[model samples]
Target: MHTDLWNYALALYARPGVEAACLQLQEDGADVCLLLCASWLQARRARVSDERVCALLALAEPWRIEVVQPLRTLRQQWRMAAQGDAALALLREQLKGLELQAERTLLERLQACSQQWPAGSDETADDWLVRLAPDLCRDHGALDQLRAAASALQDAEDGD
Candidate 1:
């Protein structure tokens, strides 16, 4: 499995609308990360799949293909064509873009979820979400909007 791609999807899982999409995809027996990676790979014109990635690399069946194959391909190509630094550099840039998008999406989701938290419960809402889905909140990073929501709730509680 491509660790980078997996991390990217894991980050995206914290996004708004992504959890629902991920749940639906999960229900359909698809790895959400793999799907996201596939989308990235498709955009990059990389002909790869989670299945092929697992088969070739002996990684988990539901691994992210986008991260692995392109890197692997780049490495192989670089080995064959030592002067192909440009191609490798391009692939790295694209991966960085994907990472940034994933991070932004995650922050958006966290903000949305925090906004939708029930009134009269600042820490409670965060706790509930953390309990319900730890992966989304596990050191995922500070969401300033969510923090504001929590702060507002705390103030309300103090006023009461």
Candidate 2:
């Protein structure tokens, strides 16, 4: 498995169906960054705990509220306008970049905070995914697809 959260995320997200699954999960109000982190932890075999979940949530919520959401909101709001106006489109593209950067920063923070967590626990990645997933998406199929994709990514790595 990849050692860094960002690369792991990029790899996992690049997998077939993973991006769509993440988009679906995002639509259901789950944090994609958190979901990616959960997948990373699961790949790493980190044991999930209430305290760890709480810690990750506490670290992520504010950043999402203060940074990521605003960029995302603005970019989404400009979707129509950006299509008609080249200037607006450029600005929207920049906003998209900013939103991506914000997400990247959040991933970095999550990785930094969770990197020290030791592995070798009985907790499966499903435990991490389920624990961190929003209640709204607890039973969603996209979450299952994400899990399956993660497993496939891990399996591919294991083969290598």
Q: Indicate which candidate wins on TM-score.
A: 2
Query: What is the per-residue lDDT of model 2 for residues 1-160, given as tens digits with 9 covering 90 to 100?
Result: 7999999999999999999999999988999999999999998899888999999999999999999998999999999989999999999999999999999999999999998999767756448899999998889999999999999999999995
Clashes of each: 2, 0
Q: List the residue pairs that clash in candidate 1.
A: 15-109, 16-109
For 1-160, candidate 1 gives per-residue lDDT tens digits of 1223334344445555566655554444443433444332322233333343443223323123455334434545555354457786666667656644643453333323233322332222123212222244323333223333333433443474
Candidate 2's TM-score reads: 0.96
Error of 2 at 96 (Å): 0.5
Q: Roughly what TM-score does model 1 have, to 2 decimal places?
A: 0.28
Scanning candidate 1 in windows of ten residues, the lowest lDDT window is: 124-133
TM-score of each: 0.28, 0.96
Runs in model 1 with CA error above 4 Å?
A: 1-3, 49-58, 62-160
